[model samples]
Target: MLYPIFEYFDQVLDIPGTGVFRYISFRAGMAALVSLIITITFGKNIINWIRNKQIGETVRDLGLEGQNEKKGTPTMGGLMIMAGIIIPTLLFANINNIYIILLLITTVWLGGIGFLDDYIKVFRKNKEGLAGRFKIIGQIVIGIVVGATLYFHEGVVVREFTNPVSIEQGMVETPAFKDVKTMKTTIPFMKDNELNYEKIFGFLGDSATPIFYILIVIFIVTAVSNGANITDGIDGLAAGTSAIIGLTIAIFAYISGNAIFSQYLNVFFIPNSGELVIFCAAFVGACVGFLWYNSYPAQVFMGDTGSLMLGGVIAVLSFALRKELLIPVLCGIFVIENASVIIQVSYFKYTKKKYGEGRRVFLMSPLHHHYQKKNIHEAKIVTRFWILGILLAIITLATLKLR
Candidate 1:
């Protein structure tokens, strides 16, 4: 909204200092500041409203220390996060950018799905909120939309040289480059890091490539979203980890969108994706701001609303920045948390079938809960997990040069 107004001010009105808004870094900083202000300042009021409406968390007796104390805390504080991200983006980002459009849609789409799940749990008194199948379907729908848009949109193109150009080839001088739409994505830790989807799906013929790409997109969106949801078991785990991941993605967006940096780093150069840096800035700020109340001894919980949206947006940004392949490393915490659950469930089923007695892997399912089961304080577990998340983030950033 404000992008065009600032443009008019700089161009038509010739307003002094208005030209600063033309810089992505300036706008991104403003967006992050605004998001932090909104989430922190108005968060209390939103929490009060939710609490007044009797929208609180209902904790099951999980036999974990201090678990019962969390019951009745205001839930659905994700409203604050959503407002923090959307309002700032509208005010500071180019709303017409297709990448921005898809991100906004993903935020609303996944947020709405999570809201419904929380609503069912709180209002309808159904512990099993929103059938699992339905949630997967919603995720698949958004994945298809994002995948199809990136696949078909003309504006979504990567800059490629007619002759193979590399850092070794000397990018000090401008080289002939053309923007073309393709299914190539960045694969970390390889010298020639680009992976074309055609190499894997070409056997099915050209027409089937889009289908396979969309299917991969759907899988990523669903997996990460569910990973975050399950990781939300402990306070500050999801939001804090998400903040780290978002910052890493924002760096990728900035580097990929800048031609000079892309050439120097030998990374995929995506046109017009710099706008995503602003979106990701808002995301990181919102998560950090929410952590104020979402941390240990929380006053409010983000519930599924914030968790699902965070994961979905991260997945979409990775795709937009061509860094989707780095998700396993960057999102290692979410992956491990998700894997713990799957491993436990699978192992339990196998043991039950063979020995007619259920066996356990960890003391509990998700890794955090296992720590809690080991008598580790939730705050200590959260802190350790956050430290691990930071380490993973650094590794993720190192991929920009490590390859």
Candidate 2:
């Protein structure tokens, strides 16, 4: 919202300070600071309002230590995060950018779905919430929209150079470069790192490639969003881990959007993707600030609203940066949390079918609860997982040069 006005003032009116708004770094910093301030300042009031309204989490009896204590805490605090992200993006980012537009849409779309789910659970008095099938449908719809837009939008294109450039010198002046639209994504730890959808769907022909790509998008959006929801099982786990992932992606966005950095790293230079840095900045700040109230002895829970939206935003950001393949590493915490439940359920069913009795893999599902069953403190479990998340993020970044 503010971007264009300041730009006009700087360009047309020759205002000195207004030109500073043109810098992505400056805008990103402001977005992060403003986002932090908004969440921290408004979080207390929102929590109190929800508490007074008696809108609290309905925690199932998991039989874990300290589980019952969280039963009636104020919930659906993700609205704070939504405001933090959207407000900053609108105020500091160029709203006209395609990347920004898609991000804003994603925040609202998935947030709305999550909010509805929370509403059903809290106000409607239905523990089943929005139904699993309905959630899946919502995810699929957004996935199709995001995939189709990225595939068909004229603004979404990657720059390819005709000549080889040395990564050491990092020359911006290349022999020639062309901005072309292709379903190509980055592959980690490979000398030739680009993976094109055309090659994968060669047998299906060029006409069928987009259909397959969109299917992939649908799967990714569903999987990651669900993964995030599951990871929200404990306080500070989801928000803290997501903040780390957001910061890492923000770094990637800044580098991918810069020609010099892209050339230096020998990576794909996505035109106009730099604007995503501002969005990511707000994302990270929101998550971190929410931690003030969401930590160990939590004051509020993000529930489905924050969890699903966080994962969806991350998924879209990865695709926008052409780094979707890196999700497994960068989002290792979410992946493992999701995997624990899948493994436990599959093992239990298989054991029951074979032995006429269900056997458990972990003491409880979703890794964190298993640790809780081991008599580990929730705070300790969260901190350990965060450390692992940081390690995974470092490895993910290292892949930029390891390739």
Candidate that would win on lDDT: 2
Runs of candidate 2 with Cα error greater than 4 angstroms are 162-176
Q: What is the TM-score (0 to 1) of candidate 1?
A: 0.97
Q: How many collisions per candidate?
A: 0, 0
Q: After superposition, how far is residue 191 of candidate 2 from its true place, in Å?
A: 1.0
lDDT of each: 0.93, 0.93
TM-score of each: 0.97, 0.97
